[model samples]
Target: GAGVSQSPRYKVAKRGQDVALRCDPISGHVSLFWYQQALGQGPEFLTYFQNEAQLDKSGLPSDRFFAERPEGSVSTLKIQRTQQEDSAVYLCASSLSFSPGMDEQFFGPGTRLTVL
Candidate 1:
């Protein structure tokens, strides 16, 4: 079975541009999550989805961030009005269960976003 995967491993954007990142989770996984990591910092949770339902998005830094899992497997994270402060690695993870703290999350190689 395939593990989580992300696209466009690297991106360079000018400030104020918008970017979209994609994620493909392992088959049959029930939960998906997005995270943001600044340089030299640990990844911070950004949002969570159970199947196709978005359950939490409290960690998104601002309204510029958005995420969705419309079909319960593939997910997307969109960042609008990119800022230099938003330059970082965006990670995607998936688990077999919805219990975030208990279930082991499999992480994909992150997509590094650079805002010039």
Candidate 2:
């Protein structure tokens, strides 16, 4: 099975533009996570999904940010009306456990979004 992978590793977006980042996690992993990492900081949790159900989205910065894992495999993070503050590395992670935080997560390379 493939490890976690993110597409368009780098994205340059104009302010107010909407961007969609993709993530492909390891096969059979039941838990998925989305995070935002700013310069010199650690990844901050954005959302979590178990199977096809979104279990938590408490860490999303605002309503402009949304994530989904519709089929329990591939996931997407969509940012609408992107602001300069939205510039960051968007990372996707997955784990074998049904409970996300309970297990060690394997992270993807991340799609870095640069808001101009």
What are the models' TM-scores?
Answer: 0.96, 0.95
**lDDT (Cα, tens digit) per residue for candidate 1, span 19-56:** 99999999999999999999999999999999999999
Residue pairs in clash, model 2: none
Query: What would you estimate as the lDDT of candidate 1?
Result: 0.95
Q: Which tens-of-lDDT digit does each residue in 3-101 have in candidate 2?
A: 999988999999999999999999888999999999999999999999989999999999999898999889999999999999999999999877525
Model 2 residue 70 distance off true place after TM-score fit, in angstroms:
0.9
The TM-score measured for candidate 2 stands at 0.95
Relative to the true structure, how large is the alpha-carbon lDDT of every model? 0.95, 0.93
